[model samples]
Target: MISLVILSFTVKKNYTSASTNSFTKTINTIVIDAGHGFRCENGCRHGSTGENITEDQVSYEVSKRIVAELKKKYPSVKIIESRPTPFFVENRARAEFANKNKGDLFVSIHCNFVPKIRDVRREGTRTETKYVYVGKGKKRKKVKKTITVPVYKTYYLPNPAHGTETYVFAAHKTDDKEEIIMENGDIFENEKDDSTINNNINDPLIKQQVALWTKQFFANSVKLASMMEEEFTTLGRFSRGVKQRQKGIWVLQATAMPSILIELGFLSNSEEEAYLLSEPGQQQMAESIVKAISRYKELVEKGAPQPPVNNGKR
Candidate 1:
């Protein structure tokens, strides 16, 4: 089991002629969000045994590991844990904490599952892949061979489609001023952005900077995800690739900072569930998180060398 302890640190800042207090350097605070709670029941089960692994327990365990890792490596940085224990945090509270702290980043951890398909793939221009949950004592489907893209990194979760993934949304580019035609054919202004937010995307320079930063954040997340996979692999877990999701998710949408929700592995997988609940597995995950954060800090200070330049149209 990992420990959560909060510490304080100060930043140095120089004062300008007119300012009484000026911060010379910015001290970043990271908000670690562990999704779901132990008390809530979602009908979710462990993959390998079809046993129950409550969301609270999983998130709590993962969060504890993550916090411990961050503190060990980034002692100067402030870490505000959203869920310290199993009973106190919820999605709304998590968002509120970030907002209150003005967090530099937010990360929510989770696990994934495929209850429908066991493990099947189909070839396409690239390749189509599907994940199926294989229950205990259930020999469901034959492995289908096709040219589809592998859903996960092979280092950790080797069976296929069982591994870690990260994601970010493509920038919203629909013209803000454009009128929306209702069913009656009446035009109404789109209100996603009012006048204040409009200026952000309207400025070409601002848009470029935002896009660049967001991309960099995504790359950083991928690096962390890869590191975690390696750590898990060393401890004998599946390695899923750092993935991108175009669709909006709750944590992604709510986070004020660029964020990623990692589906570490499926509790639905019996073997995975047992491992995740084990002390060694948890420690491996924690160590991976620490390593990833260390790498991320380096990239942030020096800049990601291979930053994705794509405008996200693809």
Candidate 2:
């Protein structure tokens, strides 16, 4: 199991300035993370697979198309990919890349999966021979008897669950979010100077600032996630809506920006797997993501208050 490191900090003063302080009016850099990667020889880190298709394969393809579409639509925006190849990258490394690049937004693409359901049926009956005692203890005798038993065959069928959902960092994991912000304070700094937040992390005032900034990041993450799910719904795809995992996702909370992880569809479902593996399906998914980002960019740059996120159901 993956472990999260949580840090404790005390806030003495209410830093209202942190709330008003905006990271940037315009989003200049966006990070695209293709979830999972090829399995190693040690039989670890392999992502979900079904119908001979792997989650890494689908995510990588979709991420590449998203990059292409975003570049075409918004030429000025800089795009960085966490995994440009199929090789496995640690969660820490992916977050580090986004932080080092000073990404304004982070999007991680992935396919969902559930275990196959077991299906059992009685095929036919067969004859079996067994030994049985025919009498009492002293006079007991072993006898061979023939009996018929039902034969059952078990097989696995694809799971029926299919849909798209978006995930932001769980609200309860704000401490982890604050820790990430403090560690990469430079990314959130408005000005490049000697008095950066990193220099005074131990100060109560600095801790308060980090806490407020984390709140802002969380709100923005929810807004972006809702928008992505809306786009998916518009395409007539089943939208599972925006969600927060009780167990924190490392890459989502560790990135020092508005971040989201998208579950495109379930690979264990044969129909959805076929759709995800098709050319047009990949293009459609990529276009929907780009459209959402375009709208999010406009809203943030205009300094407009984001619309309240609803349940995101159609």
Candidate 3:
């Protein structure tokens, strides 16, 4: 029998920047973005299968659960949701909401899409245009796993890759945490060894500390990603590894908090698409996220920032 092994560690409470208590610094405001609406309606497709699923619908389902879980724990915490219903919202509006509210962290949830390229007979000019769409058919059938064969100028746009991803906005300049990690080793030398310190990618003490913090962030993210992937996998979800992207996503850049985007799976994957559109799949996805967030809070309380969670078990 195959066993799923999940590694978790308790993190010590982290003090805020002002040297206040960990509880004081911990972010109390969270902005949950359910992604932008695809202007074209009737819902998006599940790849070439013609199974229809709306982007707005998926976002709402995932965000609702995240909000519910957060509210349960952080009752006093402020929660701002971009869209609670199946409505069209723009990217700019999403960014502005987080900014105006002074939200500490902004997490924008979205599904990935890869369009197909096809020929267009516009104005008698037979030029190629990139336009791929998913549509619903009269009846639903089992999803097929095969490549589409195109003739003539029927360019096949690659399918959108799925799996989970967490992105942090690129830093324009050094952050305060990075600056501190650079100036001092005496403060943390007792907790971490020289080889461990030297192994830091940036090597700068300040950068190292930031790296350590980010690593901790990724650690928590991975746990959540794993949980989601596992549940989704059994239900036919894709297994995209948890990765960090430094590009500036509007939500990631606008918030003052450390945030990442979790791409649950691709709508283009026939098998995964069907699973995601189902009710059971959405619940599992939400539960995975809640577990990850709860675990992160627990880690922060334990002060286990640098190394992987070293619990007694493997």
Candidate 4:
């Protein structure tokens, strides 16, 4: 199992920094990020707006349920939330908060956009060019060809695009994830053992290992993502499968934790939108997330000694 492979802790003797195989300490705390808030400008919603229940509202609702279920199941596990209200939190700030609180995992929840008549927007680009003189003396002369770049707009109209999908930072961008994790060591707090505190930080190999650990995060992210999609499909939700999204997915990369951004469903689709706003739908979403997390936690903790961890924190 991927969980068994990842749960195996790679404890380097006499080393400092985070434990690459530190599931016992790492999975003790969880963080939930409810994506984008409802903000109106000129009587129009600015982001993820549809079906009367905005994306943020649905995410928030689903997140609250996830928190409740996690607590109900784990009891002693610590849970940290990025937002406690219907407010907007910048992606970087959300990641920062998760790290500051020493969250072991970060789950960002969002509803996919269902393009609509109102959701449609126009955007396009054009180009222009000029020619210079051949010789130095001739170059000094003002010689250019005139051109008029035409303007165009693509109407992003409403479509019946709906599904439950999960995302991780583009795995190919491993260097970025490594740098982010290294700069913010709090994510690796599990490595701050008294024994390894004095371990040399100058070792080139240790740095390499730290970078390799980031790759593991990508792997784990993908693993958990697949689990969520599978869970959703089992529940009769249309699963779009997992995908790597680099653009517009900052929290996944910026957070120094195993992170995943989930698109619960598309608001454009009536049936999906109804489910998203319904209590049962929200609860199911939360259940899927909790199940995935529990499976992951169990797999990683297998065979590994359950060292007592005082995870009694907010």
Candidate 5:
């Protein structure tokens, strides 16, 4: 951390990763996004079908309950959900709303499921019957007999994967995300050129500064995500480890704040689907997330050291 601070002042402007924000901003408002509220026809579409539930439904339910829990636990903290109902909400719209409201943190709630496989692998015993003639005594005659034989089969099957995962933006998408932060909504174009926002694209100083801030914010997002995984693991859920996804998910990258996307569990798994739809399971997950946020707030607000970089490509 000390070395990082030294590099911020002494390093060349083109060296983007070394510099960092001079101050640690406290999180006062958090924007919660429920994944897959909209269909492709409506604008935003991100979801998977489960055995008994849908991603859009589960995400909205979980997000609504999490908001309830957050309100109960942190009365002073302002909480906003990108979608309170199952209405269509575009990803860009969600990001724009959070940015317009000056949200400090963005949390996207979603459910993960292995897509049902059309090329399914199968294995089972097949029934076989054979007719044979056997007689001993005075006369031999064809007799009716049924016999069962063991058989085997092999084929493809639907994936039954289940787990919990957390994600931050990937590094390869840094430039695109930086552009979003720079030009999306209040990021640029409309923002008046000041010491913070610079119109001169050639001047690498402010660009570097913004880059450093986003890098550190990415670091903080990892910290919070790790804490969340730990909390979920403690609750006896399978921890798929924190992930870095570059494709498909856009809201996290566009927002001008530290962000994370939580994959609660696989809806494709029957047991997990039932659990996620239950009152008890939803309450527990919401509480665990709130606890993780509380811990993150305590540590980050106290100016903890920047977490070591562990960005991944996938």
Candidate 6:
């Protein structure tokens, strides 16, 4: 299992200087990644599974809906899919595809899961016979004893941890993010020429530029994640809020552009699983995401100042 970690970092002078520049960035291209799919080597790679539904299936369904809705509402904006079908796509390959297409934002959809709660109860008592030594030394003799033993039956219940949350890459993992940005500098709309930075990654100026871009991406990711959680909350869903893991999520950090992975809800919860599998529930989730993306685009184009990054509201 992949565990998540959270940490905090302060924004640097470079990012502050860059943020004051003219608002030239626009969210022209968005990449939507369905969490998992079928992998031949490992068979099916469903992220999490419920009694009758799987995370891969739910993610694909929600992603497809989001694609359709975005196309309908923002016809001029280009939308790309990381996994168009229920087939495996390597994590690195997915990030490369997003960068290659010059995606402005990347949204990876997934389901949350927790182990079922185990409950044990004494169902009844059973009679048992055992041989025991009766008294002391010579007087002691083998005796048959009848005893009653309590029998316990264990059962599983769905985990109660059901809610929606979003994830951004950890701040301490900036090196990985910086390397990706250095490799694909052109993806940063406000940054210098791709070749210039890529060719002079070791140069002090280029290194500073990459670091600024990395921080900007992190800030944007946190902003977008917060907006998504807000949307989920507005839709009457519990919001676990934005989160970051100390260990980097490959899809989130590997992409050059701002990226986030959304945990729609806990599939291990029976009620949430039914909700995720239902048509209304899926449509509502897609709508919430689409709404958030629309707002994020507007804010970015308007040059809205990014909110300060913190430990996040868990």
lDDT of 1 by residue, 1-314 (tens): 00000000010011112222211113267777777664446554322222567545676787888887788777888888887776645566776676456565677777676553444443334576555545456666546455555453223333334555555433341111011101101111132212223333344443433334344444554555566566667666566656655454655555445466766677667677676777787677767766665665565545212322344531
Models 1 onward score TM values of 0.57, 0.82, 0.53, 0.74, 0.73, 0.81
| Candidate 2 vs candidate 6, lDDT winner | 2
Please report the candidate that would top TM-score against the real structure: 2
The candidate 6 region of ten consecutive residues with least summed lDDT is 1-10
- Can you give the lDDT of residue 208 in candidate 6? 66
Worst 10 residues of 2 by lDDT: 1-10
lDDT of 4 at 121: 38
Number of backbone collisions per candidate, in order?
23, 0, 15, 2, 6, 2
Encode model 2's per-residue lDDT on 46-80: one tens digit a residue: 68887768999899999999999999887878888
Model 6 TM-score is 0.81
Question: How high is the lDDT of residue 143 in model 2?
Answer: 97
- Clashing residue pairs, backbone N/CA/C < 3 A, model 6: 5-245, 5-246
Model 4 spans with C-alpha error above 4 angstroms: 1-26, 39-46, 116-158, 186-202, 305-314
Candidate lDDT values, in order: 0.52, 0.81, 0.52, 0.73, 0.74, 0.80
Residue 55 lDDT (model 5): 87
The Cα error of candidate 6 at residue 159, in Å, is 1.7
The Cα error of candidate 1 at residue 32, in Å, is 1.3
**Order of candidate numbers by TM-score, starting with the best:** 2, 6, 4, 5, 1, 3
Comparing 1 and 6 by lDDT, which wins?
Answer: 6
For model 5, residues 1-314, the per-residue Cα lDDT tens digits are: 12222223332333545534443546678888988765657565458877777888888888888898888887888899877778768788898888777677889999988766655344554565666678777776777666655554545565678889999888777776677655632333332322233344345665666577678778888999999999999999999999997573688788877899999999888889999989899888888998898888887778643532434510
The sequence of per-residue lDDT tens digits that candidate 6 reaches over residues 172-271 is: 8889998887776444333322224335557675566567768878888898999999999999999998999777799888887789999999988888
Q: By the TM-score metric, which is better: model 2 or model 4?
A: 2
Model 5: weakest 10-residue lDDT segment is 1-10
